[model samples]
Target chain A: MSKPVIAIDMGGTKIKIGIVQGNTVLSSDSIDADSGSGLRKRLPFIQKAVEDLLDREGISLAEITGLGMASPGIIDSIQKKILSIDKKFGDAPGIHLEEWCLQTFNLPFSIENDARSALWGEWKYGKAKNFDSAVIMTLGTGIGSAAIMDRQLLRGKHFTAGILGGHSVINYKGIHCNCGNKGCVETEASTWNLTSIARSDKNFAESPLAHAPAIDYELIFNLAQEGDAAALHIREQSVQVWSACAINLIHAYDPEILVLTGGIMASSSQIVPYIRKHIETHAWTPWGKISIEEGEFPDTAALLGIAHLVGN
Target chain B: MSKPVIAIDMGGTKIKIGIVQGNTVLSSDSIDADSGSGLRKRLPFIQKAVEDLLDREGISLAEITGLGMASPGIIDSIQKKILSIDKKFGDAPGIHLEEWCLQTFNLPFSIENDARSALWGEWKYGKAKNFDSAVIMTLGTGIGSAAIMDRQLLRGKHFTAGILGGHSVINYKGIHCNCGNKGCVETEASTWNLTSIARSDKNFAESPLAHAPAIDYELIFNLAQEGDAAALHIREQSVQVWSACAINLIHAYDPEILVLTGGIMASSSQIVPYIRKHIETHAWTPWGKISIEEGEFPDTAALLGIAHLVGN
Candidate 1:
């Protein structure tokens, strides 16, 4: 039998680490991260967390084949390097991630962008096992996505192809995204930009949500369910944006199945069916129908995906 | 090459067939096509044209390893089948294209959608050869596009991926596309839809182009250069729509190069630079810049691309 593997999921607020023998998660640990401080500092903090887990579990470093890390940045997987860092992780690009792994555990390792890694996880052990071509979209602070085409991750020539699905324009004249493009689906709707769109509405001054210090999809869905007019309006609008984006994905990628996952999908009971219905009506697929499913593994998909990566 | 291949590009107006040895077109013939007559009638005409080319060039059918044909539709490349038909083709899905080719020539045959085949031609021989990842947008009667990712054609799971670039939503509330989607890039800016969009603008009533029998980008570009107010207004709008769509491709596919080729790109002096400027300013690629260029072979790209398929 092959040895177990370690998988790490690096996130903005929390870090999820786990051990997997095959498709099943053996044990896992979670910790709050000072991600705002930048990944350079977070690396040592993560090292301490991994070492503690290994010692507590009484597992030797040698028994662990290697580590699979899912991170938020443009990744040069072949070179095992991070290419760019967004605002969340300030100094990630310069971090010597591979060297750090080699020095710490003396093992080979692989890393991929978080969404792409999550796709790997889902394809390997979760919802998409039987599929070869699939598009995975994570509707969170910003929309994140990755595509698997013909059994391979479509990194493109610039390592950006499958990773930039969120930046697709759903409305050409709607709003300008931080990515500098106009009317991106993420700009129109995402947990990060949801409040701004709500404030722009004419009814915001008298709305109940105006009283909240910060806004997110959770509060929006909750308030909408409670029959708040402004919240309901925003919720419907958000759903349209996501639905339109999903339709675009269906047309652009031509996948047999589309996987929807993310923190925003916590209210998926309201989101998934709505998106599925919209794509059914709006998408122009002539051959057959495409199945849209709520992602089964939330945080654990990439973690399991990493374990599979290490095995390979 | 292992063996010379026969490549055919079938369009609504003309069919071009030739013997292609590597990137060069050896013996070629262009025949007018009466697409209104339907596929059953068009096939014999095309077959005679191919036969004439073979006889005139003194190329033996036995020496041809395979045949490749490019048409406008959703295609199953693996099965060498055409899966759908647009209005111009009358009805094509019922035809057994591969079977006919195999029986007629006693050789294996392959077929693909025209836009994708054009992209393959460009990647194999034209301007896109320098870049492994690229997007080719053909703005003719309607907009068509093909994407090459990591040096391979991205057929997606359902043969829909790159072929749907024209249907990208540029303006959410702009116009209704024939495909059931609203405000698609093609509906707003392609040659087929440009006349309607221009007619909707109030200024078009007074423009020189309004007097033309058939309005197209060629007439609009000409009138815009001569300082017609309505033509200039529509020209600017078309440029913006194309630019927005280009930026969308830059974000969605993250290709290193975007090759613009089509009947409309005859005015590429205006279109290519405008798209390049917009993408350079609007896209959020920190890796570097995306290069936009007019394709070296506009109409013949698909024909040459068919040769690449046969060679493969």
Candidate 2:
């Protein structure tokens, strides 16, 4: 039997690590990363975290075949380096992720952009299986998407092709994105964009949601379901924007299925059907139907994806 | 030395046939084609048109390495069949393109969606050769697009990926497309959609454009240049929509260079600068600047693209 692989997903706020064999999770652990801490300070914490997991599980590091690391930034998988960290983590671009793994465990490591890793996971072992082409979207703090075409990841020359589909424009005259593009789908509908979307509403001043200091899609979705008119309007508009973005992905990647993940899609009961119906009505797919499905892997999709990457 | 290839471009209004070798046209001919005449009837005309070129150029069929065909509609290059004719040639999907070529000249042939083929031509031999990731948008009868990723053509599982980028929605409540989608880029700004767009304008009744029987973009652009208020408004709005679409492609495809091709780009002196300025201000690429340029192949880009496909 093949040894299990370690999969690690490094997010802006947390780290999720798992021991995975094929599609099943053998063992897993999570920790609050507090990425605001500088890279140097975080290094020892990461080492301790992995060591603690092995101790708790009573597993030897020698039993691990490899490690797959998914991080939130532009990643050069070839070099195992984060190319641009942006605002997610300080000095991430300078870190040698492979070198760290080599020194610690003497294991081969592969790293990738979080969205791409999630897509790799989903396509290999989750809902996107059996499809030659698929696009996985994570709709959270920022919208992230990745395309798998002909059963291979469609990373462009700069490793930034289909992954940027979420930033596709849905409203030309809408708000500006942190990426500097005006009216991007992420700018109009993502969790990061939702606070302003809620604040811009006329009923925001009178709604119960106004009392909440912080707002996210979950709050908006729950409030809308509870009959908050302001929340309902934002929710509907957000649905439309997300649907448009979905259609754009459909058009851009021509995938057989779209697997939607991210923290926000925990409300997939609302999002999947809405996007599916909108696409059914407005999307142009004369050949056949395009399926919009919820992602089976949630927070751990990327981590699990690392296992698939390493195993494959 | 390999002999020159025969390239044919079938359009809604005209069919262009030429002998092309390394971007140089040794001989070329054009014939008016009414696509509404139906595909079965047009085949004889198209074949005869090409044969006429063979006669005029005195080039033997054996000397021609292969024939490359570009047509407006969805194409299954693998099957060598037109998938969806898009109302231009309703019977095209039923026609056997490869079989037709085999029976006619015992020659192997390749067919591609016109927009995609144009990008291929340009990427392989024309202005877009420098960039590995690029998008080509053709703004003619209908807005069409093709993308190149890591120097390979991006045809997703459904063979619809990069080809449908123009169908992306710019306004949630914009015009309806013939493709059963509402608020499509094609619906808002294309030769086929121009009539409805102009008719919906509030000032259409009062404008001098109403007096003109034909209201194509040429007249709109000329009138706008002459400071016609309504024309200028429409022009500005079209530019905004096109710019927004370009930004969407830039974000979606992550191309360092975006090549705008089509009949409209013939007036590139105006369109190139407008799109470049808008993209510079609106597009988000933190790494460096994105270069926006016009297609040097003009209308023949798609026809030449067929040869590239066959060579591949």
Candidate 3:
């Protein structure tokens, strides 16, 4: 049998590291992250985390195939390098993860954007497995997406293809996104912009949500369920933004299926069906209707994907 | 390379027929079109056009490699079938162009979306020849686009992949489009919607443009050059829409070069520089800048592209 692999899914707030074989994550560990600091400073911490996880799992470095990383940046997997990052991982573009792995673990390495990695995870073992072409949307603090066209992950020149749905402008006259574009899907509806969108609403001053300890989709969904007017408005508006995003992705990728995942989907019970109806009504797919489904694996998907990447 | 090829570029208003070898069009002809009437009625006319062209060029049927068509619809080129179309070409989906060619001229044939065919034409023989990856935008009565990612044409599962840019919603809350979307790039700024967009402007009733014979980009560009406020406003808005569209295409396809074409680019002197400036200021591309160039051929690109398709 082939050896197990080490997978690292690095997000803005947390870094999830795990040992994975086949489709299952054997054991995992997490580290709170602060990307504002350059990536070089965190190398030793990551090394220790991996070492400790292996020790706790009673596995050795020699017993694993390699290490793979799912990071928040543009990546060139073949060259095993991070191409760029957004105000984070300051030293990443200049650092070669493969060289780091060779020097430290003396093993092979691979890396991809976290969303694209999760797409592989979904396609090989979850909601996207049955569809030959699929679009994966991860609604979280930010909107992250990846697309599979004809069963092949689209890694365009510069490796930005099929991964920039969140950054696509769904509203030309709406708001300015930090990415320099106006009214990107993420700018209009993602969790990172949720509070601003709520505050800018005319109903905000009278809404109960204005005084909440912390604002998030879970709280928003709960308040909206209780018939809070501001919460309801926010929910309605957010879903529309996401639905519009769905239509945009459908037009751009022409996928057979769209897989929805990420933390914001905790409200999937409210979000999924609404998006389904919206697409049926508003999208221009004359060939046929596309199916929308919620994803099964949330926490472990990128890790599983990384394991698969290392195997290849 | 071995022999010449027959090419047909069928547009909403014109059908251009030509004989091409390598990078040059040996001879060409055109016929006015009214696509509101179905495509089947014009088959004989097209057949005669090809026959007369070949006769005048002193070329026999056996002198060409094959025949290819650039049509305005979704197509399965390998299957040599038109899969779907707009309101026009009601009978296209039911007919096989390859079979028609075989029966009429004993030749093999292939068909592709006109925008996609033009992209191939540009890639092989025109503006996009220098880049391995590119996005071609035809700005005219509509905003049609096709992307080449990593030197391969991206024909998605339904063959709708990069061809639906005109339908992508750039403004979810703007006006409703005929394709069942809201504020599509075409709805916001294409030639078909130009009059309506102008008619809705607050300046319409008082402006001299209110008395124009018919409203179009050429008049708008000319008036704007003469400092007509409404025309200046329309020109600015149209260019911005096209620029946002360029960003959307860039984010969607991740191409290194973007080639602009079509009749609307008659105002390229005004549109190209504005879009180029907008992208530099607002696009999120961090690796490097994308080059934008005007296409070399206006009337012959899709035909050239079809020629290359049949040659292959």
Candidate 4:
């Protein structure tokens, strides 16, 4: 029998570590991610997190066959290196993660983009199974997306293919995105931009949401349920943005299944249906309907995916 | 040496027929495509057009290996059938082009979406020859697009995959498209919508363009050259829309080569540079720059592409 694997999902807010067995995470843990000082500063903390998780699971480094790490930004999986990161893990390109893994665990190592890793998990073991083509759309702080088109992950010549889902323009004349484009779905709607979107509404000053410490989808959804005009307006607008994005993605990649992930899925029951209605009304799918699924393990998809990444 | 191929590019306004040898169309001719009735009514004319082209080239039916048709609709290239078409050929789904070919010329037949056919030509014999991934953007009456990713054409499960490039939303709140979506790049900038875009400009009534019989990109570009206010306003706005679309597509398909085609390329020398500048400034390609090339055989790319499609 194959030994267990160690998986790491490196994100902007958290570094999640897991011991994955088959398709399941046997044990998992996470640590606060602080990139203000760069990735090098967090190495010791990451090492401790993994060790503690292994200890709690009663597993040892010698029993692990390989380690997989999912990191943010552009990744050259074939070269086993991080290419570039705009905001998080500024030191990623300089850090030799594969070498670090070899020394730390003395095991084979592989690294992938966090979203792509999550897609790998879904495609291989979760919702995307049996489907030849699938797309993973992760909605949270910013939109994270990856596609498996024609039964292959869309890795373009630059290795940035299928990872720029958040940056695709959906409203060309709208707000300029941090990535340099304008009217991107991420700019129009997303947790990080939700506050900005809320503040931009004409009713913000007169609405109760203005008194809140910070704005997020949860608060907006909660307030909208109580018939807050500002909240309702923002919620419906975000849903349209997301639906437009979904249709745009459908036209771009033509996936059989679109797996929704990230923090926004917490209110999947309330919001997913609106997205579905919009897609049904506007998406030009002549052949049949696409299956939209919520990710089975939103928080740990990248971890479980990294296991497949290293294992395969 | 392989036998020559008969190529047909089925457009809304014209049915272009060609006798193609290698990558070149040795002889070509076109007939009016009157779809006011149905595709069945045009079959005999299509037959005559092919025969006339073969006669002009002094080629016999036995000298041709097969017939390839590039139709404007959803195509099942694998099954050699048209799946659906909203406009040009309403009876495409019921017609048997393969049977027609076998009966008329005893030749094998294959069909593909016109955009995909053009992409096949570019990828196989023109600008995209050396690239593993490529995308074609044909900006004319409508925005026609197709993609080749990971060394294969993106023919998704239903075969409407990469051909819907123009329909990808670039502005969520912009013009609604005839195909049921809003803010599509096609709706914002293609020739079919140029009139609406021009008329919406406040200066349209004062500008000389109001006296013109038709409002098209040619008129707009020509008027802009002469410093017409409405023309200039619409021209700049269209340019921005196209630029946004370029960046959006760059993110969507991640192609190494983006081959521009269709009627808009008539002003390629004047307009392509502006698009290049926008992509350079806004496209989030961290790996490297994408090569934007005008299609080498814009008028006959689909013809040559059909040759490759049928031959292969």
Clashes of each: 1, 0, 0, 1
Query: Model 3: how far is A132 from its true place, Å?
Result: 2.2
Tens-digit lDDT track of model 3 for A1-312: 457999999887788899998898989998877777878878888899999999999999999999999987678888888887766677889876788888999988989888999989999989889788999888987788899988889888888888888888888877988677888998998877788888887888888778977788898899899998888988998898889888888999999889999888988999999999999998877779898998869888888887898898
Which candidate's TM-score is highest?
Answer: 4
TM-score of each: 0.92, 0.94, 0.96, 0.97
Worst 10 residues of 4 chain A by lDDT: A149-158
Listed per prediction, chain B TM-scores read: 0.94, 0.96, 0.95, 0.96
lDDT of 3 by residue, B148-231 (tens): 987889888888999988887788787987677787899999888899999988888877789998988899899899998888
In the predicted model 4, the residue pairs found to clash are A171-B171
Displacement of residue A102 (Cα, Å) in model 2 is: 4.1
Query: Taking the tens digit of each residue's C-alpha lDDT, what string does model 1 give over B125-196?
Result: 999996878898888877888888778887877688888888887776567787877778888888767778
CAPRI category for model 3:
medium
Model 1 Cα interface RMS deviation (Å):
1.5
Docking class of 1: medium
Q: Model 3's lDDT to the true fold?
A: 0.87
TM-score, first chain, each model: 0.95, 0.95, 0.95, 0.95
- Cα displacement (angstroms), candidate 1, residue A278, comes to 1.7
Instruction: Report the alpha-carbon TM-score of model 3 versus the true structure.
Output: 0.96
Badly placed stretches (over 4 Å) of model 1 are: A55-62, A104-107, B1-6, B18-21, B26-33, B51-67, B102-109
Each prediction's whole-model lDDT (CA): 0.82, 0.81, 0.87, 0.85
lDDT of 4 by residue, B188-212 (tens): 8888777888888999899988888
* lDDT for each residue of candidate 4 in A1-312, tens digit (9 for 90 to 100): 346899988877778888997788989888888876788888889889889989998998988879988987889998999888866778889989889888877889898888899998988888998888898888887888898876777777777878887888887778977787788888889986788889989989988889999888989889888999999999888888888888878877778898999887787887789877778888888878988888878888898888977877
The TM-score ranking, best first, is 4, 3, 2, 1
